[model samples]
Target: MGSRRTFSRRLGVPGRAGVALFAAGLGLMSPFAAAPASAQTADAPAGTWATPPPLGPGDAPPADSGHPDTTYKKKNECVQRSLGQDVKINFRPWGQDYLQLDRAQQIVRAATGSVGGNQKVAVIDTGVTPHPWFQDRVESGGDYVATPDNGAQPGMQDCDGHGTEVAGIIAGNPKDPQVGFIGVAPDARIVSYRQLSENYAKDDSPQQPSAPPSGGTGAPPSGGESQQPPAGGSSNSQLPPSSGGGTGSGSGTAPQQDNKGDSRDLAKQGTAGTLNTLAQIIRGIADTHRAGVINMSVDHCRPGTAPGDIQEGERKVQAAVRYAADNDIVVVAAAGNVSENCPQNDQADPNKPKSIVTPPWFSDDVLSVGAIQEDGGVAPFSVHGPWVGVAAPGTKIVSLDPAEHSNGLANLTIANGNPSPIQGTSFAAPYVAGVAALVRSMFPHMKARDVVKRLKATAQHPAAPGGRDNFVGYGVIDPVAALTANLPGDTGNLSLPKPVVQEAKLPPADGISSTPMIVALAGTGGGVAALLITLFVMHTIRRNRARSSPPTK
Candidate 1:
């Protein structure tokens, strides 16, 4: 965790002594940074932080206006008390896996019957927003935070760029076709679960910047109320109402922006409750067998020796994943973006062991994904773990970011777009999840366990291993290899043929001269003339006999 070097891929060669590299400049920073928990790094490029277009009084459209679903109202009310999007933070890109991602996609198409036909794949992460990639891609799963009254909607609006970016990777279609960074199965449906909506997406909570940090030691809240902070704490900040018009810093003047639904009572410990509700919804989907695959790009890091504690909220959430799998759904997760300084029993923790990811205790069904560099090496930021199942492209990987509609595929290649270069395990998990959908699409009847086996078996080994590596588990998932590699076809349908009829013909009369029938008839007529003369003689004899008999009488 000492020397920092920028490798082409996020996770570089596994055993080559990884130097934990932190890209705080990108939107992703260590959880321990001193800045406001919601603050984006100043190092991010101009466009990401470029003043969002002057949001007029009606500029930031109401979350429920155009959508027919009523769930928007419920979710908006639930998250109104939290911090909203801060103009200062730089929105990070999903990073540089575009080329490899494209290749992987091709392989999926060749293998799967069709790219995820109408199947909904839900990504439960920080809130997501509508981007060109997903402009028409999402359907409402209900905004869990924006309005709390209901729990379903069509648009997956992202206030924080994180969730939207992850969703885009899972199912985004680029505006510019010239740059091919389309998702693995762009046609597949997407469900956005607003899990990381707290400080990240909608934290209107009064910020007493001067208050001391408690490091999350407070007791869990009782009942479904917002838990109030200890006494002497300042109240939550009131966000300037959203403005409809004006540019730069001036956009905060609008009145409607401030009316972002109703605030929840802070006395209730509602974060956990909110999560439980989200989990129940997910479990319900699994029970109904709705989504073919579910991608969770969010993870809670737990310290060593803390046997069962991982965010009291996460413990409940992971159980939901198990429940989903019991009903035959596939759950995929990010290992985490905390590889830079993974703290171990007090030393630099250089054992290069499996202490990185969470829900970390082995879950056979969960496919823990670690990030890898373009050179087929482990990304510097990727967390390693024993539970790791496979790897996908996660370095400087290009993906959809909702905050700035600027395209990642185009921005990465060109210099002009608000290029906030990004890297993390968040980008990696979707690639695999998308591929999993492809696998399921092609082999619709294959069990989740069988699909896992095919993915592992098809994965090609990278330059550094006899088998699986700590950095690139089973090597960067070879989509072409994974999809085409000995996949047995499903035998659910077979078409039988109908019976056929044949006509018959008689051979020409045996030896009748083989001439015309008229000629044959004329040849037989000469024989009939001789028979006529014989009949005349017999007639004359009968007449003479009759005359003689009359005389005798």
Candidate 2:
């Protein structure tokens, strides 16, 4: 059955037609493709040029699908330790872990003379906890969701652990030097926006007596699709009938009783709701003139299959991205999670190539970050297409996990908590976002285009047919090069002088005559005018002096 399944599975671009067309188009259009390798100087590693198979992390296996009636409480437990602030962790081989980051830091430190002093980054994902990793590192960016008043509600906190993991990568600070984590920017502040609601539908609803505590990790993988909460199950009295259309009043709500239903209920797309909330936050940021970066670790793809045109949600997102750019804000989004397929198979219509980050990465204004493996290769599970701006570390990456899944251990707190190694393009995006904040901090007046250009120019190209590959864009981001790279932005308005026409011949003495008439006449007129004015002024002064002297006498 397995052999037949493998044989039956169609791979590569559907047929050779697509490949032939793409190659022909490239030959006719791409100037870089024709440029000689020696002239270009840099290159990606040599490999047979092959279109990587469409891939995705797809559905996790049945064994990994189920979740506990309640989330694991230990996952949320913070481990307090007496370790000092600056300890080196042997998280990986010392040579690999610290060498690159330390070197990069040194370069940035030398360039800027400090970590970002007071720049804020909005982590638009699951809420971050008050850990030392984020100690003195966050401001109360109001929670966007109204029903869930506090961080305890869904979309107010992290339940799946994806957002928390990404946060730590961008800003975690573990106490243990030997076996914990340190973020890319420890001092930079974070504003958490819980994009994914915590009260995601679960399969089982534990009764009052049986309901597990808030911070408990439920039994691992009991069956297919974890326990889901019923739609409109929790506190309907506090929530509006439809969380769409218009803004609802934000009122305080309490912990609702545990009620379980299908997981699909949680998958509802409130594009309007999400965009409205995002707009409000962005407006606030702009109104206050707060210059910072917006870190988006989530992205949806092009919508429309057997239906009408794409939804307004995508448009709203595009507008928000444009708003961020126009307001001098840096917007960063994840390339996306990849299952094993080449392009993701749209659950809506598996037959078409209908997938990539939504609004095509909000019209490419936002920097779309892809995932790279430990070997600096594109992660097998990373979705790659034209939208990719750059690649960053996204493999078995260790970062902050929520307390419910952090497992009472501090070391585990920094480790990838999920079953299949919490690696995705989501984590990679924040690394770049942190770097952007660093760039904005150093070059306060830099625009979005300037930041993007410098990042690409200074990126360390991966070894290959190697300039910018679809998979890794320009290549891994070089923080050191970025900080020191002299990429210039728009320098407002300066006019250049026109070139003078120096003639080979003087034409004639007539040309000289014309020049003499203008010059001599102008000089004589100026001299006569100056003499008359001087005499008149002297006479008037003498008369006034004589009258004043008589009076004085």
Give the residue spans of candidate 2 off by over 4 A.
1-90, 93-99, 111-113, 146-156, 175-180, 201-213, 219-284, 289-291, 302-309, 339-353, 404-418, 462-466, 488-553
Pick the TM-score winner.
Answer: 2
* Runs off by more than 4 Å, candidate 1: 1-113, 148-155, 198-278, 306-314, 339-356, 360-362, 404-420, 462-466, 487-553
Q: What TM-score quantifies how close candidate 1 is to the native fold?
A: 0.54
Candidate 1 per-residue lDDT, tens place, 72-175, comes to 11111111111222222122333334325555666556655446765678876645555555656676665444432123243354433355656767777664
Lowest summed lDDT across 10 adjacent residues in model 2 is found at 221-230
In model 1, state the lDDT of residue 270.
26
Q: lDDT by residue for model 2 over 166-220, one digit each (tens)? A: 5666656554566435667656777766544433332233542232244322211
Root-mean-square deviation of each candidate, in angstroms?
25.8, 24.4
Candidate 2 residue-pair clash tally: 50
List the candidates' TM-scores in order. Answer: 0.54, 0.57
